[model samples]
Target chain A: MRYFTTTVDLKDSELDHSIYVQCLQLRREVFISQMGWNLYQHMGCEFDQYDTPASVHVVALQNNAVLGCMRLLRTDNDLGNATYMILDAHLGRIPNLPSGIMDEQIQSQDTWEASRLAISSRVPTSERNAVLVDLLRTGMEYVATRGGTSLLGMMNPVFLRVFRRAGLRAYKFGRIADQRDGRLCVMKLDLEPGAAMVAA
Target chain B: MKHPIQEKFNKYGFVILAPGQVPSDAITTFSDEWKEVYFRNEFHKIDPVFEFAVRSTRNSNCTLLSEAQMTNELFEEARMFEADSNFVSVSHYGGNTMVFGGVNPELDPRATASIQHACQATHRIELLKNLDLLTDTQIDLMEMAEEGFLDKEIASEFGISLSAIAQRKQAICKAVGTDCFKSTLRLYTLQKWGGLVGEYT
Candidate 1:
């Protein structure tokens, strides 16, 4: 099953211990152990500043195992001031973004950013593919329900091609140079509210 | 390909397709080759990932298929694409399916929703691409309309008359084939004019 849990919605004390722990384990396996991303290297589970109060985590699970996960942060929350998108968090300066990249004023409330996308490598090969799609389904369903109109985040090149191929009205925002993960670029996926893609 | 998108597939190990290309029989793999799979092999119907992806379009909620679906031969073949590492993202919009995923190392679910929204919006744009949906002034006005800008607020932001705004909106709706400009905005919240170049600036 797939659903969302936010620091705002579910208290840390009330967390489903098994699922939450699995999320941390999955992060460790995907980000640290497998990918060698040092930033996520922690005491067997990866946690960061972005996992603050009011942060949303969309998780997918099957057969009692954590399938995949991602995090969404609402800038309107108090912690939002603590950590914004790649702009304030990594880049330190917002790009002279194209007009619809999102208004500086409106982004605070209506726009939320996604990060920490990870999938466990331990699942059996046959089930791995289906689990990945489950994660996306859960995450987007969460955003749509929250009244989100756009997603602003950073991605590397390989997945960027996937988004374009997937038909996301994805556009270039800017580039993040001098990062450990090569050069990361800014991307935006604009949403159409209540408009479904009908075959012409 | 754009840096961010490629990195997502590399980092997360998955990709999604636009609505127009979903139905194509060609499936891409981590090695960047489009393999010709007979899509009618019935695996898509029984595959939980495929079913959940299609269900994601109709409802704004994520649907998780039962664990039993992983045992199917078709999904088994797809999983074996990259040695059981990455899977493709197959998303549907309106009625069209944009089937893409199974690239990189391991596909993550967090990218799915963002990918689906992006795919649908971009697909919507492609459908309206020929219509010249927005004039220069109209585009400017629409940007103002974002972030809860009302007609009055947009008019004030653009320093234009409300009637002018109304007329511009009418033209946009007429051009884009939406019932009204509001609906067009709901479906085609476009930021870039050029269709998915898949490259970094």
Candidate 2:
């Protein structure tokens, strides 16, 4: 099987074309057309404004055809902050979990932040999940490189479980509420290096 | 003589050549070369598909089976793959059995109902027809529709200020005559596009 990967810096206008359009279409087809998520109203085609300049896009290809894609946004900016605030109110309060000596290493770091993530269903589950893991790891690494101590986000519980199982210190923040789809969890993960950050 | 299969394998990650297409001598040569490269392993499967357990690792725990089995497994798993005409078909497990190929649309009933309720509550369709009155550029700006992209992303994608996207969206709401942007537009669009004849007619 032939495989290829490309990172699309949303900052680059060269990649803003039909390929991105197709990716948006797939997102709509899965998240809207089929699933009936009313989150986005259809334009002439599937798209929305969040595909802006700061978003980092990654696409996977097989035999020259796009198989899957994802977008990552750095949350350093005011509006680009993580989903924690929206979810924090609903989730109530963050729980205190047991931490190891590694927690000290993380707490010593100065800054902590998070990001927003969106993924397409076009890629196979295995490949897509692997890509997600890679993206998360990359994001965490990027934060570490910047001397940040932690990463946080409002993630679906299922994904939170994946993060926890991978040895990341994923915690639920705020109060839990029954969403239309079920309970939504405000998840946080500390990214400082140490045994505690290692997957169990 | 070297087999053509070996030569193809060297060039392509995998191949599915039709039977009797290559000369016997070339096949032998290719097969020998393939064994050398692949350590005597035959290309038993070419991009075989597999349905995995929900919690399985992305790299492991998938069962390789025939296409039919894969489809059946996916059905059993309640997962869907998008089906496209141009997709190549292959199975994972050993055997020659074949089944439907391509990705099937996975629908979440709850999500659908949520969308329907939101659409009905808001009237989405009526808003779209009025979209023409907006500038061509404004119309082009509407494509980044996913909720995840947020306001800032919308602004950058359209090369407009965030305030501009918000204002245009507000204009869209006023044009469609609804207060809620998402729900109203969806319901309006659905009702407008439902019948055999166009809603405008």
Candidate 3:
């Protein structure tokens, strides 16, 4: 598996556009079609207000096809009327997430939020775990090398087991909220340079 | 593989919690509306089921919500929303608490035992909340312990005295709310694996 980062800007690169499209479609298939989440979609691609140029898209590819993807936004980022998604949710700006989900408000260059992680359902069951490990390792390295100390995000509680199996250490913090998608809890992962992968 | 506890208790509904003031991070199979009202109204503040679980010295609390309890203000308010009644509320409090409420009049003995095990597992992850308090050496000790290293082996590997190893292990246990090396290692593994990650398809 190969992983890379790109943005949604087609004009930025003629080469990245194809990969970005695959990433968006992967999200569309997972979030909207499979999980039945109500999201912004156009022409078989899923995106929302958070998908700005400042956002980094991490895509997992194998055999030249997108297998998984996630989006990363620095916690300190400010894009006009919005910050990051989790912070916005905690401030009551996002209606779907409860206001008190996070233990404390965070805005720091050393921290980033990883969101919209989706692996292709079509991947063979035996290979899904490898895809997840690669996707997370790639995302972690992307942030760790860029001076991030931690990664914070919301996830369904059951998904925690998969992370455990992958040998990634995640700590659950704050309250678990009943969101429209499912039950979710705030989690933090401390990062170390070149330490993204540990023997599973 | 499905969790054995989950499979055994598939017929029941419950909320499992770590050591926290509220059940905000509870693992529950309760209905959405039930949670909506329970959390929106901040009823956990007055929830007798939760109160019993939090205050009881015993490891387990098993009782049907009495007619008197059902008539109480909390349940009265809950009833207006068409919540289920004749409820049996069973909770097991370890480092974490598994509070199971169901309409069933009779609960299987095995189900309650499963709830207890779930609480234990839930608490194992909750122990990680204290990770920041542990020093680098203490953290390394924990990792080594999780890798199945014995106390003597770890002491030898770190070139520390056996007494020094014991001191650090005790500190680690106190920080994470475990009593011994075995449980502490369990907590470490749970923290390592019971975390959120990019979802697998």
Candidate 4:
């Protein structure tokens, strides 16, 4: 059996409650224990303010088992996606906040921030790239359908190389020290009229 | 809007390199010192900015990447050019596609506008190709899936065989490379109208 991707609305009530719990559990396994990001853990899952009604969760599944997942949030929405960009401000060091990209992103409502892309380390290496590519393409398709033109994310050097090599068009911008790792930078991928950057 | 390099920054530049071809455009405001360092370090191996420029075909509007978005190495090297922002875009005309890149000294509109209009207006024809397009039957199946319809419900509503619908759903899932039904529906919804959407004017 092959894998497929789907979106889970945090606000949807008719869905199986276990799937939501499974998402969180997978996130805890991949992001918390593996990636070591300092996210708030609830019931063994990781999440933060951006996990509101506005958040869009994309999951990769194999035989109904969660293989990987990622989240999307509109930058201009009240979901706190863009608001979280100002880490320095949150630390009372507003003086060091890099506001240049924010000033431009705020002026356009077509931008969304993608974060917390988690892939199970247990997934065989053969199936790993497919999961990541699927999640990314699904997210891009989602943004384009919403009349939005851009997708933003904080990517580490590893992801940066992967994206460029994947034939995805990403524009790297400001960098910040990762809370645990060394550093990561912001990237913007446009989903406008021409997405021809797909690898040939 | 009042950044010092606004005027020079808006003068965006572009060059067309086909797939698998490396960019050799020499027309740029930055000096050779940093460019050499950038290329020597194989920055292109991880340069998302350059990748973005070459991937998507855009209109004459300028794209802005703020300081917060810059990568550490890129930012450190860009500081040598005294650049604070990047104003870049790509476009297609006739059979030729080109990616444009330049500086935006600051966050000014006029500055970006200048860059957007800087492609020398060459190959002025709009591109005729479509990026990703889906079929009507696919769209219907996707919409039904999107509405939270069960496999049986979709079969009943469409007067189709349940196994056939199941097979279709399976195909859709494989095409999207995910096991999630919602993601398949989401992909279908996005591409139902054909993967191309106009600017949100």
Top candidate (DockQ) = 3
Instruction: In angstroms, give how far residue B63 of model 4 lies from its true place.
Output: 58
lDDT (Cα, 0-100) at A149 in candidate 4? 80
Please estimate how well model 2 matches the true structure, expressed as its whole-model Cα lDDT. 0.40
User: For each candidate, how many residue pairs have backbone atoms clashing (under 3 Å)?
Assistant: 38, 46, 2, 18
lDDT of 4 at B137: 59
For model 1, what is the alpha-carbon lDDT of residue B191? 21
Better of 1 and 3 by DockQ: 3
Residue-level lDDT of model 1, residues A65-108, one tens digit each, is 66666677765655534556554544343332222222243345
Clashing pairs in 3: A164-B193, A176-B24
Per-residue accuracy of model 3 over A54-167 as CA lDDT, tens digit each:
788777666667777788889999988899988898888976567778889899998899888777755544355566656666777767766777888787553454565457
Model-by-model DockQ, in order: 0.02, 0.02, 0.06, 0.01
Q: Rate the local accuracy (lDDT) of all candidates.
A: 0.50, 0.40, 0.63, 0.56
The number of the candidate with the highest lDDT is 3
Residue range with the least summed lDDT across 10 consecutive positions in model 1 chain A: A94-103
| Tens digit per residue, CA lDDT, model 1, B1-201 | 222244444422222343233443432334333133435554445555556666655543332233464456664775655423234344333333444443343335666666555534434534344233355566555544533468888788678899988988776665554445655665443322121111110
